[model samples]
Target: MYPKMLEVAKSEGNKEAERSFHHANEVEKIHAQLYQKLLDNPGASRETYAYYVCPVCGYTSEKEPPDSCPVCGTKGKMFKKMD
Candidate 1:
């Protein structure tokens, strides 16, 4: 778990590991929320919309990404479309 890794990294005073784990933890939270949303509404996946992910932060969106990533402020155009 990224959070657990982050905690260990913090305790060890490893700044690089802390940063990496922090980033992963943030993305993992977004993924979990997205997965929970889909689980809550099982039919939501029936749509033919495409998914987009922020290259910088791994933020995901359906149909279309926002003008800027809420987590990292990466532009929508920078997001990569999922196949």
Candidate 2:
């Protein structure tokens, strides 16, 4: 769905839509991979750390946020922290 939206956005020359849909598609792929990893290791130890999400692109990071969002170039300071 997101990939299709990205392609449509690109075809229509909507830069903002393209970026947003592309970011969502990429993030969903990462989420699937992480979910698979957890499923493969059900007993993995859980560690406590701050989780940060990019307000513009939905990019997620643990421990600390990046200096800049790799997806949408949003500044680290703009990230929303999750408890």
Query: Best-fitting candidate, measured by TM-score?
Result: 1
**What is the C-alpha RMSD, rounded to one decimal, of candidate 2?**
2.5
Tell me which residue pairs clash in candidate 2.
Answer: none
lDDT of all predictions, in order shown?
0.86, 0.79
Candidate 2, lDDT over the whole model:
0.79
The sequence of per-residue lDDT tens digits that candidate 1 reaches over residues 15-75 is 9988877777778888999899889988987766689999997989887989999878899
Off by over 4 Å in 2: 10-15
lDDT of 2 by residue, 1-83 (tens): 77777778889999988876766778887677767866887774265557798998788876688999887789999999986
- State the lDDT at 27 in candidate 1: 82
Q: Model 1 misses residue 54 by how many Å?
A: 0.9
Candidate 1 is scored at a TM of 0.81
Error of 1 at 39 (Å): 1.2
Top-scoring candidate (lDDT) = 1
